[model samples]
Target: MTSSAPRRTVLAAALAAAAGAATPSAQAADAARTSEASAPAATPQAAARRSKSLVDYHSWTTTTDWHKGRAQGTGITHGARPGIHIVHPVGTLDYKDPHTGRTTTWDYAVWTSPAHSLKVPATEVIASWNAHTPPATWIAVELRGTYSDGGHTPWYVMGRWTAGDGASDIRRTSVDDQKDGRSSVSTDTFAIDAPAGGLRLTSYQLRLTLHRKPGTPLTPTVWRVGAMGSDLPDRFEVPASRPGQVGRELVVPRYSQEIHKGQYPEYDNGGEAWCSPTSSQMIIEYWGRKPTQQQLSWVNPDYADPQVCHAARHTFDYQYEGCGNWPFNAAYAATYRDLQGIVTRLTSLTDLEHLIHAGLPVITSQSFLKTELDGAGYGTAGHLMTVIGFTKNGDIVANDPASPDNAAVRRIYKRRQFENIWLRTKRYDAKGQVKSGSGGVCYLYFPAKPAPTQHRVLAELGIH
Candidate 1:
């Protein structure tokens, strides 16, 4: 379903012109030719919305290669990039002292991004990755930022992800404290708490480590590693999304949080607080995958929605003690068969529309008063929702997990109201220029096939 608007009409024209001027790749051309032959089309508006080349173009940069990053560690073999390779500790193996019966086992790998100074200091760093099977078996991330004066923040342990229970494990919070806005208990992401003036970091470096047990033959293959920067400002005014845009409203399966409420009290009573997992589940299923039977077997059989429980368990940050960690959710999605996920900041509703038109639904974060986001009927300091598509007039059509039941999951919000809450930025500065900050954080999932380019074109409107 779609609604028409003035802005969409203009976008329709622009896309048409682009389609004509460009020479698409063979795969993209075939998809476009096939769609045009089979699908009913009349107006330029409808044809623009149904184009495949547009989607393929953006899809090309969904995942990035980190091979250029430096790699260091024992039992490491290269595979495209750092942290992604075969690990076999064969030479000078860790040995046990017969006298004390103590052994020293060291097998690990590290991938560090190229050190680069920045003009605008970043307040937060988000690292995401995928490993074979048991996702975070033995992994940790450390980051450091150097100030213009040459002073540097000592390397901080963003998080140490080890699968089993151990005293040495130090992972970031997976959930946040709803009351005080602090991390719930785990630490997966790193944030530099600079003074009001902001930290002027001249250089930044991120390192990811993959470790293994001393004598085990088991080796985990790390797929890739990537990071993003965020600056959390003090003042953010939520806006209302007004009319005039049209895009496809995908039939993304709906799941209501209400059904799972009280099913698992420890996890904020299931649906009532599992918006992140629920949204994640919906998108994962939309991609034609679901939690395996073994994955959900841990849950009580009486629970109707076991997948939501499965998501919560895997996404739980032991250190954070919560399931809503932003990067963790994206990483969890990547655990599935073909789908790969990335955490990035989107700039505008226009960028979102492109993904939707490309047949991809986006998961987004927002904070707002009930009145600020009309039709939601509820307010939150923060929340996550799935942006499925747009209404004819350009309003947002979403699968809001906030609904009490699956039947009530789909919602259409006013464009400006939804955009304001979704992006969480100032409408304009004193000088009347758009604030242009990407408090508009989102999670993008794409297939492993047709791998994304080295430099991802994440934003359609170039706001970020």
Candidate 2:
């Protein structure tokens, strides 16, 4: 019950819970389906041990040492600026296995420079990256000799994650660089956002402390690979001496005009749901800086799941800090009952027979989907979305990430077609409607903070 390593012990107990947890898979078959069963709390320790059994356990490392990859091809060109570059390959590193060896593969991307850039003293700087999802954690990135680290550190931490299906979660910090003598190759996995179809828009960092080390001197790498499995053009046309270099978030729901739109320095979404990152990108542009391509995406593990309708109230609270507890839907709930977030989740959604009490807004999806299905009249299988908010008229207003036009729509349920589409999931409300407005559920996401409509983000890129 009491942990020797408070955080570690806490992590261990959480992990134990994850090992025994299970989540209902929604469209688990669909590549883009967001619906997922919330797994229990996972101890990265156990998952790491079990990963060997679940995955083919491929290692992409080439050296059993702490040797950096050679600078090849065209390193990111910063107009005239420069910086450092760090790469993490995919797959398992069997340091636990006696003869398994280590693996660290290079990003399929080539760079003409390092992973850092120099920002002029006291002057705001601009840092940008390209590619698909970057690493779950990064070791080090250099910018103009000044170093900014990511992942987890002794004091500051990025986050933690569970690797692979059924694999234990790892308590990893992005900035921690603890490489024991032995080494293994990294086997990088590519997400849809990579050099392929679809886009989840990852790779955070545009704000200060934005993380990284300055390479060489008086130089900034304009373009570099910021993604995990792929490459992106880290080009910057601005300079540090020029007077502008900070970005802000957006006030309205907007879309980037291109794959290379400029993004904000800090793309944090804690204020709101997935909108934080999106607004950050927009903020940077509206702040006077030319909008470059940036990455951003929203995740709803369950949208069309019949077993799990809306985001379980327990989940949002548990993950309000971070959804790292997922994979094992209900892990850590019992392990640490006193924790604030934990306590919140436990009481949010209690079942009272037919009515499933929701903590977050639970709108009628079955009804809405049915309406869309009937309106389209003849289409393929329909799906569900999130009910974010409501209009002044008490009309249910929500957002369905799948439907571009899913914003604040009222004319969905027109006929029996509306009723039929929702029937597919069987998650209908007590009255058999897609979204019933009876539960006292917190809307999924609300505007966190207001931005200055007239404010502009100005950035400066100093070459040292």
Candidate 3:
């Protein structure tokens, strides 16, 4: 009884990619949207839609050891960079960074699947890196499954195996296979056929839904990313995704206000409004249906932990007393990182609401925050820019649709510079909510099939 599959369409990059945003353009501000809407004009926008700009990117040579990319076997330990929930249904699984001292990332993604009755397939899990070498960089994507009966009965991964990169062709084997290491770039689209269970959309698919392109919001929970190899047929099963329930565009009027003035005199330059919350708000709105106290309870903008203060102290203070778990929560933000590895995920095209529901952090890193501050080329300016996505080269792109003179180039922090700014805060217990005096349990739910919710303080917003 699966709902009709949505129409398929080509997918946009999971992350936003706009560089050189220093000031806000009155005209630009008047035209900008939030979420992926915050990205700077795409390199091709001028040739297409003549879009405005919102974020940027610059690569670096930093490497973080992560568990092996493939989940089918033992985990690989790369230096810790940052990671977030693969997908989301609810409950916060936090993991703070030793560097940021905040939990903004999650090791695994949980779905509300019915144990012994329902089974959800992991769609697409990908990782990209700068290939010091060209043409022959072996791209490896691994899949590993960890089960915990201590928490839920059907929570166990009977047998987690990968079906990409290395496997018999789908014509020979019906299931998906591991992607080839030869095609390791982020832009590469690994192709495969859906097995009997088909595939479930990943948070990545949700990331691309904002645009509502023809083949989008692939309901199979399939990974709508790129392919990078020979067997790669350069194909995609895009679904006809509409703008979900998140209606109307936030910052529309605000952009109008800025554009009318011709420029944002606020930050030494730009004229754009910080469209950060648009996505997050949209998700909440969609989930609310009739609107309730649930949606308004807490807002995690990745600012609650000391890691943020330490990294981007000047941006969001530790004692600012704002959002529940946010970093730069000058006031009214949300923080959701604790446990093992914490990461702040910001996609230029990403909507906060989408990430939240998928269990990802909607905030930017302190290093990233500083880059915006520095990028603005402003002297003594305090602006709030949201983290979008980074490039293979290590550049941190962001959405600062508000900088006037330098708003367009407001923030494009170097990896090192951004990280330096994020290390000034004092540490707090990211794992514990309400001062986290003790530890709690984690659960996996499959849609309306409640997994386990005894200790978690459920928010009215459902799961975002």
Candidate 4:
């Protein structure tokens, strides 16, 4: 769902690889093991240092965070959860929604964050936000970055999003064909045109434009706006880590994408391509938030797990033509009352273990060949699954949606193999060519009011 190409096709064309990238083999695995054994023990400080160099995450979440940003026509709402809302009309614009093909006038206001320097000069950046958009309101998130060479990137639209799919709501989408000679946006991610040539985004600022029907009191309240910047090293394999949370597993719900196949073709050609939303739905429900029966009344009665169908429709990205827009799925989970979500990258399975031990199941993204992951039974260019827990032997316990039924969704995968596929930047495809890996991409959905331990852990991981 991340690309326009079919899921089974080789992803190397979309995610270009560096020259002379090595193929994955037994020798690569052995080398990774030797490197891990020869390395010093990873203390908390050492892990943080390593993670900071690979990925940097920044967000504006507090009242103080909102006040620091320059607001044209927006005001800060301070309370238990501080946010920004439209206060006065700054301007108006006419937007012809491509999906709806209707021109509508909307009152708009803008809030621009102060420039933030990334800890890691990044080769890629993906922005995410949490907001409550009423029936007639939606938000557009854009980012402008300064390159390492002192040049600037034009403002690129990260996403046009809303929580509703009502008649008046604009179809949530990611913009296409947005690129300069030095950089370009692929769906929700902003990528340097050629990172191997030493190009990196050093600093960036985000612009949040809140839109609503003209002359109405309705306004969208934005609680969080952030981006994950990463410069993961180009490697086909990464050092394996020993599991710390063996024999512990969170009981996450199981849902299969295959069961919902051909259910809603308009949303990414049916459930065959709904790995993101399907995996998202499992975690959303695991957190005890689900669509009410009334909310799901639109679904067909004949379909099993109507909520799965509901998720596919809600998370569809019209421009990308897929349901896998990272921020879109996060925003959709936030729509539920007292829930919040964000898209971020975890450094390793140790990070996943921390969340799982706190009773939080993580949704992860990765791509691999049929032979790469044991017991997977299939390969994918890109797919998402819920990592529920670790096995007694330190393997991964995942509720993979690419199964024949809900009961078959739970599978055990080798820890080393899964970690490499998830964390590596480069990987080999079925054709023995280099392709991109997800570099530990994941979605964290939890209660807006988290438990004390949950809050502490999330804060430690820089989520607040």
Which candidate achieves the best lDDT against the true structure? 4
Regarding TM-score, does 3 or 4 come out ahead? 4
Candidate 4 — worst ten consecutive residues by lDDT sum? Answer: 20-29
Between candidates 2 and 3, the one scoring higher on lDDT is: 3
Measured with C-alpha atoms, the lDDT of residue 134 in candidate 2 is: 26
Runs in model 1 lying further than 4 Å from the true structure: 1-67, 74-83, 86-106, 117-120, 133-136, 162-189, 192-195, 231-235, 238-245, 425-438, 450-464
Candidate 3 per-residue lDDT over residues 1-464, each given as its tens digit: 00000100101111110000011223212322233343332234332221121111111112221221222211222232232112322222343322234433212322221111112222222211211111111112222221122211111111111111111101001112222321111111221123113323221211111001122221111111111111111111112222221222222111111231212222112222222222122112122211233432232333221121121211111121111112112111111111111112221222332332232222332212222335544321112343434444445444443443223423455544443333221112223211100000011111111112201111111121
- TM-scores, in order shown? 0.71, 0.22, 0.22, 0.91
- On residues 181-261, what C-alpha lDDT tens digit does candidate 4 reach at each position? 888887888888777778889999999999999879999999999999988777788898997756766667789899878
- Per-residue lDDT of candidate 1, residues 24-137 (tens digit): 334333433433343332346533432321111111111133545665642333433233543543333343423234454546656666775443455445556655434324
Best by TM-score: 4
Residue pairs in collision within model 4: none
Candidate 3 segments exceeding 4 Å error: 1-361, 365-374, 379-383, 405-411, 426-464
Q: What C-alpha lDDT, on a 0 to 100 scale, does residue 455 get in candidate 4?
A: 58
Worst 10 residues of 2 by lDDT: 455-464
lDDT winner between candidates 2 and 4: 4
- How many residue pairs clash in each candidate at the backbone level? 28, 125, 153, 0
Candidate 2 accuracy as lDDT:
0.20
CA displacement after TM-score superposition, residue 342 of candidate 3 (Å): 11
Estimate the TM-score for candidate 2: 0.22
